[model samples]
Target: MRRLMQIACAVAAWASLSLPLSAAPTEPENCPGLIASRDALVSRAALRQDEVGLTFVGHATFLIETPQGVRIATDYSDGTRPPVPPDVATMNKAHSTHFSYRPDPGIKHVLKGWNPAGGPAYHDLTVQDVRIRNVSTNIRSSGGGTEYDGNSIFVFETSQLCIAHLGHLHHTLAPEHLKKLGRIDVLLVPVDGGYTLETFDMMEVLRSINASLMIPMHFFGPSTLNRFLSSAREHFPVEFSNTAAITLSRAALPKSPKILVLPGH
Candidate 1:
């Protein structure tokens, strides 16, 4: 009965948090001694353009700068900007959040869609030593103008960190999707729970990747966050930091898999 009560409390908390979104989410940008990227997105020069540490700006947007001066920004948005410009940028054909071609200019290379024009298509994006691949999603709409936006799952071969971004994911991942997304280190996921898929289905996809760190994004409210934590807590410890943001070094990775719930950008 005690465990049941705990679940009930968690459920109540979840119910209360489903409000609405008026602004982006953030943690304070100032932390003494520690290197803080001006925003979730930063110029390559910010980390001194270091190769390793990754900074998550928000939903589907990450800043990757290699030790060799190669930088790539993925899925930029309206108000989102890098403290410094990047070497490359990736956008999808999904929704406004995932891709805004109008906003992007002066990018070296751009990977267009999830897959090729035909079926079973694959997009291989390799730059220097880093690679970001694309796997088509089944998010299709009727001839009424809905579309199946092929979402791309990126991979950074240099770091051996395969990161999958469920760009407005609409269904469970198929076997092909799983096989393509083999061995992921970090996962950037949506937590509106139902808007993407049911909680259980989304959770199963996350489990399939078995990523070391799962960062929740596209969340609706605190309740959505609570629901996600409640679900993941059973399989992995959900670490809630009162922190503004976290900086990850390859050397500082956790032994056991951990889910990090970060504020959105």
Candidate 2:
């Protein structure tokens, strides 16, 4: 009975969230960080759209390919590079492994999550057919103190899918953070219980976001990944993919939230 009540509340919360755009979503300079409802978004059960490809490039890096061919690499660093140079790359300053001091000059856009002087880093832009933006979040500094706006939750909107990557998140999200994220159909999250949010807190985040698909990243090994999967299975269906990449479309998203564990290269 308790589990049923929890699920019921989750469903009610999901219904209350504002849906994405109905027509081809506009490319705004910044994500409004608010939800808006329209005839199209309300009337359509599924937005028929082209597929977006996501390839896990190891560690926290994932290469996202839009239907129009724009490619974005998340948490880009020197440790791993996409087979092809990404048109845009978003990096977080959580650690050396998450950002590169010397990025390839050929890349057109390099977005860092933190400002060198310590203010929040902000990015809201459109490249080709995809819209990219970020919400600033704090991280634990190497000195064991809180670093304000040291990380970012980057969102990519394309093919009618709102995909967010939570970069090296250290704490549970605040109400303001949830408002800024709007509706996330897909979420790329760090699952290392110690390095990122602890297992229970991470589950809370998953429940709060209520994303259609949850992809686990940044786990050190199978043991850590397995722990997350076991805990998450209670609320969300889990799927294991042999390959590192998956193609998704808004129309094909699972009705209930699902966790997809993609093999890292």
Candidate 3:
């Protein structure tokens, strides 16, 4: 009986060693250093918790209002101004229409996407109720050569959501860029087939980011917007909103990825 028990124990040990090791559980992707607790968020006004308001202000600009009443304007330019001065304004120099030489004096923070000193523009700061950061990308120069670090992809973190604005993105993202961006809940992309990336390449960018919601911007007109929508519909459902603004929350995000077109330029 003792010898039989020893043989059984040896067999069990061999089987355990022969079996393949179980794979480690995968961790969910998230934006680093952006998550904030409810206690950390300051309630400044009537906006509900975990809610953000976004309004298209024509062209590539959009006005973002946080639950804490913090206001931000993207691609801020003289032509596309918000109803009032924003608390913070983010600008890109891809075109004069995407940036302003002189922003409103009342604006508290003016973040330029490109460095005039000839390097990548860097911005990582926290305002009243949100944290804003940037990942630099290249743009096409006048001579048609690669302009390294000429553009930036600005990200806003608030109300438990990460929103990214792809400013004149000229190319598909690399793995490193995706790593830095982490998990984006909403993506504001430029869909002009000519000025920015072509339709197919822009689609590739959309796929790589894989945000829960996508808002198209920078299209010249209906023809341009239609061209992008037709291509985008093949991969994701497209929804048209009659209103120019929308409120979003983490709990209300679409179950599947979707493209939401707001009525604006």
Candidate 4:
């Protein structure tokens, strides 16, 4: 009986030693639980199965071309119009430049980030190879008061990659917001510093999101852009691109978080 008891104790100790020291959960490969409901009427072959093309069309607008040729314009407005009409156009009502009353009629979907009826705007739809959703946040009114659920952070899921566009964001993200936004592979962030969140606060927001790749937008000029970049370099490596467009893939994402500065605002 004593010999049997010693053997049992040794086995238990060995099993405990074999267990991993830290059982921290691994990061998700893609945004889970975000499923696209609608199917696209048309499918145009353009990019590879795992590729997404992004063009910095100026301001908060980025032309996102999916693998199935679904074109999407972020912060779509008259000033930041893409050369080619997009299939889906997302707009925010923070200012006249962010939203348009009359978007091109050719656009199949016009998603507004705010509801004129005075509540949160909700959107969840899929077009071609992409699933689009929005998580609403608040904004500051002209009178310096809070406008609850006035802004949106649009998330685009396609090619196993999750990309988020932070539109005229006025504050940092909450825990609930992070839960809704799943795993973001790429982030389109506004670096105007004053117009959105201040540079430091915006950096905090970026850290909270922790996207592998971050693209800066909505900057007024080089001064504002440089100011943000100067501070950002301390935290993450910065890459300056000569062109305004770049193609991204999930498998090719940087191992370490990086800030990619594309030409144009």
Residue-wise C-alpha lDDT for candidate 2, range 150-237, written one tens digit per residue: 9999998877778899999998889888877778888998998998899999999999999988989999889989998899999988
On residues 1-265, what C-alpha lDDT tens digit does candidate 1 reach at each position? 4533343343332211100111111221101001223233323343322224356666667766654566766666554535555677666655667665465567677655454464533556567756656666765553434356456555554443455566667778887667656566667787777656677887888887776667787776688779878988888877643332343433344565677765553
Runs in model 3 deviating more than 4 A are 1-46
Q: Which 10 consecutive residues of model 4 have the lowest summed lDDT?
A: 33-42
How do the residues 174-239 of candidate 3 rate in per-residue lDDT, one tens digit apiece? 997887787888899999998999999999999998888899999989999999999999999887
State each model's CA lDDT, in order. 0.56, 0.75, 0.78, 0.77
Error of 1 at 157 (Å): 2.4
lDDT comparison, 1 vs 3, better candidate: 3
C-alpha lDDT (0 to 100) for residue 17 of candidate 1 = 13
Predict model 2's lDDT versus the native: 0.75
| TM-score, prediction 3 | 0.84
Per-model TM values vs. the true structure = 0.72, 0.82, 0.84, 0.84
